[model samples]
Target chain A: MPPGTALDIRDLTVRYGDTTAVDGLDLQLRTGETVALLGPNGAGKSTVVNAVLGLVPSTGTVRVLGRTPAAAVRAGCVGAMLQHGGLPGESRVREVVELVRRSCPRSWPLDDLVVTAGIDGLLGRPVDALSGGQRQRVLLALALAGEPPLLLLDEPTSAMDVEGRRAFWTTMRRLADRGTTVVFATHHLEEADAVADRVVVVAGGQVVADGTAAQVKAGIAGRTVTFTADEDWRFAGLPGVTAADRQGERISLTTDNVEATLLALLAGGRRLPDLQVRGASLEEAVLSLTSRSRTPIGADR
Target chain B: MSTLFAFQLRRVGRNRQFLFFTVLLPALFTIFFTQVFGAQAGAAAQYQAYATASMVSMMAYGALGAALGATIRISFDRASGWLRQLRVTPVATSSVVAVDVLVGMLLTLPSLVVVALVGRLVNGVELPLSTWAGLVAVLWLGSGAFVALGLLVGHSLEDKAAGGAIGILGVVLAALGGLWVPVQLFPESLRALAHTLPSYWYAELGREVVAGDGPALLTVLAVAGFAAAFAVLTAVVLRRRPLHAVAG
Candidate 1:
């Protein structure tokens, strides 16, 4: 275990009765890096998170900041937002946060915690009275109360609307900028591609791909070409373009060959000012990688 | 564990709706049953005896209901996912269960104490200090059976079903144990059935302690056996179907 390492897991396996939920998974995360565990439902993402928290029994080594998972959790160096039972009802939001704060000896200042989670206004509200988004903000505040060096979140924004998710990720980006090691599990490819510095695609209890978003998408669906065109102008006739998506004046053409697609757009004397080309969308890359894993999920279960 | 205990106290203790059911209802029952039943006892000493016995019976009833009835909250906690959430924290699962059991037993006190005050002030049933303490202790300790039943119900059944089961159990235990209505008033066959119930022995122990009999051997064994049986049954239910919703 090095000082820069946030988490190190080797040969991790979790079983419930005869069913194996996580099978020999290995993952390592570095300090000050925000990583996403991207996968579809039942890909062992929740089981992996539970194993790291020491809430689920597993056979392997999971070192959190150079300590066992339970020790690190008790030391208040690791924080998590799990899918099940993250908050208790009947208490005000402040009480729940205060309860966690009391257990954390190296906690951050109360003011910083409330501000970072964007829950300063929600402190006076009862936990039950809060909307889903407000509750998430409070849960995030509780997760950060320990000033943990590492944070783990499981499907954090699943209950939130688009605007609530935007607010949540804004707070997350700031935490990443401030050098907190964040490991979040999300099934949304767009979220992983946009928010995370690196994405680990998991499926069938194994890592199918682990790299930067672009690297994961490198060999998948060619590239996406974007240019300013009228919504009515269809790019379907363009060479090598598999799909053309029109968004008002912005047209995105998904093509297997960027050069052939670009040549066709320019052949008709099109003056495209917002021209840009990038690796294929994360959605394609995940579909290909997750399906290519050794076992499809249903067979084992 | 202490912090969780304090939180649990606030949750069950401060809720007005539950307080009415477990505490106030039993106290009212004590006054009503004493007045209604004591009207026919011609002798003053006999009427006083009836009042004292009625008060003790209600006290046992209240404590039993409080201990057993509060387990519905555990079902709700399981449904709400609070149980699972707490498991991942520094607090151990056994500590949480201990806290719930401790809180449930603590709640049993209000009913016993309230019924005692009603007996002394309203019904003029006086007893020595030691005798009063002994009766309360007998009933309170006997509540262990109800606590075990509550835990079993809370961990084994679903949320909506657990509440109904606890309610039906309270009524049946009271009826069979001769708490709500005296077994003396029942037919010969019904009276024989009462003798077989743990509730019957549970209430008998309290009566014997109040009579300064030091809990007759048979009564003590019966109550202890029933408590042990319920505890063992609870363990078996939990092992077979772990509160998986709450158990990580």
Candidate 2:
């Protein structure tokens, strides 16, 4: 757990016109952990973040640090980086930071926060002049301006390049280590996998899967083994192994029963060599979880 | 809240376009209209009175533009997710709205000065010291009324194009109210109809002050009544359906 209870949403329902954007969705973010909210477009991820910030009207219970989102804000408990470039176009970055500082009782220095978010050089520039990634970095800086114990990031790195994103991931880890709870929402599964301590897959406006990286992957039902053998790999032909790929001396096997695969490998009739057992990546686990819940990619399952 | 109000005032000052429309442009319009109409307008005492009153009322309407620009900018804030960012800050949401209202009021002062200068110098309008005091009161009342109106429009229409529509509406109301031209010059029947408009009430307030009658205590009461009504009505609409109702 991180230092703060990042956010707690229970039975939150949001309606826009006649359509329900979020229906009875429940989520919780623990202290010192980065929880990645993964969902397709219109899956209520942003809505959940908005509800936690009290930006929109909604029905249901939401608590950030044991108080309503607005109350929590007044108490200096939470901070956020919402969608793309959430800043006034004409405002200078320093001016924007100062404005945020006025709203928050506790805040970091404008220069330090800017540097932390990798936008120190952009302080004098108008928001409209910044590149998309630079603008995002500035917005992220503003979110960190208040030194909030809990932070909500809705697609914080969506505009960043690979290197910028990697830098941001280091920043996130540092914040988490200092006990700030983080709830990050993004559509990019690989980024989520690389950075988030826990991955929560959301679909149909509900949380479909929630667990640590390895725990989530383990939930998808198989251990994969890849090896190169002097002779043909003995475990390749084992029952309960659903997939076997062989190319020259290399063999890859996916097994439904890990115990059976390991025992067969130990039998050694084909002299198994250089064997390695691998768990599924978080991306694969998320795909499998979402696929089993609905459709994998194109069609609904 | 005062801190946020100060910050918002700073933010509004950075908007060059808002300053142009609400301050510079209105002052220029007063000067230009008075120059074009001055000779014929000065011929009749009542026309001179009408011209001066119109100039004064235009000040109040310019104040309305300040409110309108602030309101629309707040709507933009909502759309850009700045409002959301504010919500998660230590500042209260009421502070955010309060800052805008306060900034609108602060910006209105310079605009009123520009209109007064145009009326006295460009239109050759004169007023007693007491009349100046009354003018301030009437302008404040008119401004309060229009700020409320701006709030209602901004709350109801959150789109950028809708802001233009409301800006046009503000200008039309001012024209009908005699901010650009006196309603007295219009036909009697039309003047009678104009009297029913809120802008006319504002214009009338200025006319009475400059003409030395001053607004009777009862008339002042009536202006207060109008301001209160607008404020109450706008507050109700805002309470019922906030601009970012869909955001959550």
Candidate 3:
């Protein structure tokens, strides 16, 4: 019904011994969409990535590019950059790049891969000698060497600096625009908001919220009402207010029904002083969404 | 597979530690043992006899480094998550192990050849060209057991512990296998214990070749058995707990 489904994961569950990591999660992505699996630590982000790569045993139906993860991998359609792994030591960057490239059923030219990853200058250097940020770029190049249609990166920018992160995401955007479906896992709210076409917020191994960044930020509280409330102002008991934070002369209230809360505040001859109302920022929305995990607050899928 | 082998060979070639143990140290041992333990030139026939056997032992010792070298690389790769990363590629997991095994065997050749050269030139151990060639061939072929053992050790232990474990194992194997000390000098009970070790069979194969005899059928079978057994154990262990570098 849509442009080929890049990824379709249904009821995916992963367990290690007595502990369950991912529980009944469903996710679908379209070709060329830049998606982020946004979550805090231990939110099953890596497990989901591992499942998509067929690296861990799990109960799930995960199809990448219309094939099983392993089959897609064999077909050279899925390339992944794991969060933590040391590249083979005693190897030059060029050798590592060529090694992964050769293993792919479909590969780009070495020059093209290096240029795309911006690691051409580091090719002949030993991998062990590269700095952390430099190594991440080299690994990114290695992942792209196969010309895979689906690019999965787990915390790709973790080792990068601010400038490196900005540069890395730019390359990702360029690649996505050219038809590669990019899926990355990160906890950085701003990254999800700025870089992802769709943000899937996960907490406690379940999809807590999933939508465009704007929609996810508006899913739970919808908006925040902030004003400088002096003492003796009891805002916590206001109508439709789910959360209230007070700091000195500033008070911020997150409300599902901003209109109702505003009306009630101005009722009884009380003035809504220094009033401010705005949609929640991605950070506020995510914090509220994750903390209310017991409720399973639904967002547009 | 060839690409993997070639890539791995380059990596192994650059590992200074592997090169030292596989080639340099063994060459040094050949000269050290032959001169200190064996007869010099113009010595008695019994002296020359002892020297040739010691030279074969050193050659066997050198070949042993191949397995140790292979073990270190495999374990390090496992611990570092390199193997896990390769799993996501199109390459089959079994192919990586096969490549590692092949690399391990290839690495042994340098040690075997260098040790034999040192034995001939520096130690003045005399042997026909054919005999020297045969000794190298037999020992090279025999090193598969060590490589298999290395693979098992790699799978069984983490990288940090693997190095020490294999080093001790190599020394113990050399001592009991009569590579470091002649089994003839061991008491009757200790020599019986040496018979059970694959390294003993590996060295005996070389001694048999240098003694102007075909490698003993039992010795060949023992070496092959060790390779097969260690390979099976490695497979079983890997299937149970793969080289998963990081837990989720």
Cα RMSD (angstroms) for every candidate in the order listed: 7.8, 8.2, 4.8
Question: Alpha-carbon interface RMSD of model 3?
Answer: 1.8
Mind giving the per-residue lDDT tens digits that candidate 2 earns over B26-67? 888777766666656645686676567668767867876776
Worst 10 residues of 3 chain B by lDDT: B239-248
- Candidate 2 lDDT over A39-109, as tens digits, reads 66677788888878887678989998788877887877888887733777557788777787767778887
What range of 10 consecutive residues in model 2 chain A has the weakest lDDT sum?
A292-301
How big is the positional error of residue B154 in model 2, measured in Å on the Cα after superposition? 2.7
- Tens digits of per-residue lDDT, candidate 1, B1-248, equal 78778877876755787789888998898888888888889999999889988988888888888988777788888777667666555565677788888998888989989989998998888888999999988888888878888988888888889999999988888898799888999999989998988778888888897787779888888888888887888778755663343211
Q: DockQ for every model, please.
A: 0.35, 0.32, 0.50
Model 2 error, position B128 (Å): 1.7
Q: How good is the docking of model 2, by CAPRI class?
A: acceptable
Q: Rate the local accuracy (lDDT) of all candidates.
A: 0.80, 0.72, 0.83
- Clash count, candidate 1: 0
For every candidate, the chain B TM-score is 0.94, 0.85, 0.94
How much does candidate 1 score in TM-score?
A: 0.83
Tell me how far the alpha carbon of residue B152 in candidate 1 is from the true structure, in angstroms, after superposition.
2.2
As a whole number from 0 to 100, the lDDT of residue B10 in candidate 2 is: 69
Native interface contact recovery, model 1: 0.31
Query: How many clashes does each candidate structure show, in the order listed?
Result: 0, 6, 0
TM-score of each: 0.83, 0.79, 0.86
The candidate 1 chain B region of ten consecutive residues with least summed lDDT is: B239-248
